[model samples]
Target: MKSYSAVVALAGLVSSVAAHGFISSPTPRQPGQGLKAACGDQVYNQQSSDHFGNVQGALQNLQGSQPDCRMWHCKGVPFSDAGEVFDYTPGQVIPMKVEIRAPHDGVANVSIVKVSSDTVIGQPLISWDQYALTSSPLSQHPDWTSFDIKMPDVSSECAKAGDCVIQWYWDAPKISQTYESCIDFKMGGGSGGSAPSPSASAAPASSAAPKPSSAAPATSATPTATVPAATPTPSKVEEVATPTASSGAGEGSTLPKSFTIDSFITWLRANAGSDTATKVSRAVAERAHPRAFRV
Candidate 1:
């Protein structure tokens, strides 16, 4: 009876030591063939028996074996066994649920991490400076087990599956124990992704439109470029009814098509014998200088 009692106590102690916490919703990475290959048979089997095992415990079993284990990152789990990827978009509110088999007061945070480099992509989606505390009643802090994480505009970085994960990290500094749970996800892709940057969206429009030449204004010395000569509107110039070669007495007359005050004076000097021209020239001069041509 004493031996049986000792065995029961030992089993309870081992269970309490191995089991801790893990992400329950969104189905996090679990032990698989890939984990066995990367973390080796001993460490892998240990974790396989108890999915909630801490990282420090896994690291201790990984001492001799150089198996592709990165115990500190995602509990040495690889993407090969990451299962289904959850699809998300920017500003999306994702509901998360965690299972805490044992409580060890610590700090916890959820962040988007790049799988390959194990680098956090941005600030944590959610965090608790003091989480899973034994001093506080579990009923007091309900957010410790269930909460929501809003997705960020990661753009193209997390567009593909297996590239990123929503990792939950919990560290108990006092006990030197760390636990991780990774939920594989893919965000920012297709038409539902974050809008393209302003510069990128305007690229095609800029390429299609004609760009102004820097030297065209200063270098082009064409007479047609002066005043209304370059203006395509000829009807405005023709609207002014004037005595010129087009409407004058002679049909084949060789004179300027449109004449200014100075040009009229020149024409009058050359045609001094024409009484009609002289009369029109005096009328124009009177209108231009009323005080000078008062008499």
Candidate 2:
């Protein structure tokens, strides 16, 4: 009975094989030859594999034990080991997924800076506030983190047709180690047409008023009196009063010519409306410039 069952199973396998024609000599197909058969011929929907065959090469290097690969189960996996697949279009939201492993105790701060020509000196063409990843902690094992980054508008001058670099930096303060991974994405679409020229609207013409030719004279009998200009007088220069000489010699006489003790004292009195300045000036003057009595 066991022999009969095995023979029946063999017959069923042979029938399945006979259904599809078999090739005696296998002929390897060229790259992209059967792509249309697998997916539609539409440019946007067309699926392609890695040209250089290096999807795994772009992944972050892992050491020791790592997290199990969950990318295949995820909705949006940024890149496949076979190759990166994306629709080249402007004004579309592109989803990005990256696997990050902390392996040690620390915090990870990820910042994305988009470079384009329209990016001004102070302002960025694609600001970080526009797109960002939610704050989440990474465990020691490998973890898949997913985020979406929108492509900048094509109308912006900064937009260019090329690969856009998405840099991921993992910082571990406790371990003092950092890991960075850069993924290059190709951008498509030609520049949009030039902006429209502004038309100059003509302004309305203003009307001018005519001036009066003749003027009426005053009817008053008494004419207004005109005052004669006074002769200009020259200002007299007043001479400053000189200090009277006293037949006395004192410490003030020994003061340098550049500085006058009496004048300094007078200035201090005028400036020192406060009692503190008056007392300070009086004490300094009495000690430094005592008056001498004449014999």
Candidate 3:
């Protein structure tokens, strides 16, 4: 009877160890090592649910729905398993890795797209090709699979200095097989991502200056001098001419021609103070009396 009891106790211990397969613990809130779920059996049905429930109960000490299963559509949510959020700058290339546990055979499709207001507030930041899992059939068993994704450059038109959402979809094909998860990350700051160029900052500076008025007068007034008119006179030889010739001459012949010439010389001397102007006047006067001023 003692031998049989020992055998039974050993068998129970073995079974208990076999029930938990690979497990990851929960992270700590204070930034140290987090709690991880112990490795357990890879069964997706009721057994997997019980295993996950044990993990959640151990951490939170609660009897509510399983931690992993509550938020996710899977049969068992890994205890203390949570996603993380990160920020990226525009035009930055980011390498990312994700591990997802599916309960059955299905495909996981990841993708990023411009987020329209109608569909969502922020834009899509990353996506991946559909990853199909068929090794473990629909046994409701929790099997973990990992994937590496490279994010493309974010365009300024699609994303701005705001928050963006990254979505992860597991078992997306069938109606009842869909599971959705998301992480909210911001894009901006002097991180690895590119920022909007400095040229954009200079645009407002140009518009701050005031414009000149068009109604002001263009020119100011200043005084100007008017030139005197020249007076006409009869020839000097008219006075010395015969009486007959004088009588036939016009009425202007009675005026003294010498007096008019003298008045012109006096005005020229008064205006031509500089020697250069006097020389120019003399040269002009000589032209009228070429033969007399030859010497």
Model 3 residue 114 CA deviation (Å) reads 5.7
Top-scoring candidate (lDDT) = 1
- Compute the lDDT for candidate 3: 0.29
lDDT of each: 0.60, 0.25, 0.29
Q: Which ten residues in a row have the lowest lDDT in candidate 2?
A: 286-295
Please tell me which model should have the higher TM-score, number 1 or number 2: 1
Q: Which window of 10 residues has the lowest lDDT sum in candidate 3?
A: 286-295
Q: What are the RMSD figures for all models against the true structure?
A: 39.4, 41.0, 49.7
Residue lDDT tens for model 1, 71-91: 656888888879767778888
TM-score of 1: 0.59
Error of 3 at 286 (Å): 99
Task: Give each model a TM-score.
Answer: 0.59, 0.24, 0.29
Q: Count clashing residue pairs per candidate.
A: 0, 3, 25
Query: Per-residue lDDT of 47-129 in model 3, one digit per residue for the tens?
Result: 33343222211222212233423222111232233334345555544333333433433333333422332122222232222
Best by TM-score: 1
What order do you get sorting by lDDT, best first?
1, 3, 2
